[model samples]
Target: MRVLLCTFIQIVMWCGYSIVLFLSHHDHNFYETILMLMFGYFNFLVAQRLNINKSVALNMTISLTLIYVTGKMIIG
Candidate 1:
């Protein structure tokens, strides 16, 4: 149940991040990158608390970020 919840939270955060990127026209300044990294770190912490594997959590974070970025680019 916790794993499912964490997955859902990550997905929602990805979507929100994608929307922000799209709105900003993908300029992606340093601050935005920092913010994204912070978010990823938060996700990692959540996954740790939920007893998820570190590698799997990291993989999911990278994959979701890539997926959202690709989607934003393709849609724009």
Candidate 2:
């Protein structure tokens, strides 16, 4: 049951990320999108390796992304 719940949450996160990515497609270049995807995948792998909860890891990733975006906007 816990595994199923985690999987569901991860799926939701992925879907949300995909929609956001799609919406902002014009804002990012292909290389930037690829790099973001790579970073997300790497973050998931590290979280799994560390035995961290999927939801927590995904939340952290979202937080980090928001932080990055916020910083970029502020700096610009």
Q: Which candidate should be chosen as best, given lDDT against the real structure?
A: 1
Specify the highest-TM-score model's number: 1
Q: How many clashing pairs does model 1 include?
A: 0
* Span of ten consecutive residues with least summed lDDT in model 2: 2-11
User: In angstroms, how far off is 69's CA in candidate 2?
Assistant: 1.8
User: RMSD for each model, in Å, please?
Assistant: 2.8, 10.7
Query: TM per model?
Result: 0.69, 0.55
Weakest 10 consecutive residues of candidate 1 by summed lDDT? 19-28
Residues 1-76, candidate 1: write the lDDT tens digits: 7667878888887777667766886575796788778777887777787888888777877777777667866987
Candidate 2 per-residue lDDT over residues 1-76, each given as its tens digit: 5444544555565556657766776774776667667766765665565666877767766665666557656965
- How high is the lDDT of residue 38 in model 2? 74
